[model samples]
Target: MELSNLTGFLVHRTDVKMTNFFTKILKQYEVTPEQWGILLVLDTERATSQKELAEAIDRDQTTVVRMIYSLEKKEIVRRIQNEADKRSHNLFLSDKGMSLKTKLMPIVKAAHDHVTKYLSDDEIQQLHEILSKLYATVKDE
Candidate 1:
């Protein structure tokens, strides 16, 4: 068992590489891959509470709060008080965020395509299925 052949090592290495690539592509927008993930989720789930956002993004609440604050400061996200919960806020993408998302969507797609350029569609699908299974197996452990 070489370190290079370890499942965790390989998956982590791939994640780091992909994160770096996404960070480079998003540098001009002043957005990190983590922030991009938040924005991506918000694009589909509007007025999501911070808790919901954290769950959706698979991040801890504290980290998600910090990311939300950064995005809010950039005018990319807006947090409105939750009517049902005084201590919680629902997050939404600002108009600027929506515009940014529109621009980023294609670029992100291109990035994905670039990364998987060598893989056939079936291979990509299989890869996703395998990854999802791995994720599920480790999620609670």
Candidate 2:
């Protein structure tokens, strides 16, 4: 079969394209997609443990740690020792991060809107379901 006809190739290309789009959108703010994810998840979850942030962002702990370090350097996130578990830290958006998040969120929304604007609501829903099922099928391994 032609490479273009392969499911993996198509999915990979789509992911790359989306990543590139977001990279361009976020370049001025100096945030990677993974970092943006950490910020968003922390803000949404509110004072989340690193483990929780890792899972919510679909990233492994090691990668999350690295991303968190970058975020910490930028003063985008702060890590606090979990009161109950002194070993693990809870992550929160720093004041600078919150200000940046406030500014970046609408741009993020607009970027996503541009991505799905061509699809009908039903199509978009179907796409989400299909992607979720695909991830669920392979995520464990």
lDDT of 1 by residue, 1-141 (tens): 799989999999999999999999999999999998988888535688888889988999999999999999999998989889899998889989999999999999999999999999999999999999999999999
Candidate with maximal TM-score: 1
Instruction: Give the runs in model 1 whose Cα sits over 4 Å from its true position.
Output: none
Q: Quick one: best lDDT, which candidate?
A: 1
Each model's total of backbone clashes: 0, 0
Tell me the tens digit of each residue's lDDT in model 2 across 1-141.
899999778999999999999999999899988788877877624788888988898888998998999899999899989889999998999989988888999999999999999999999999999999998898998
Off by over 4 Å in 2: none
TM-score of each: 0.95, 0.94
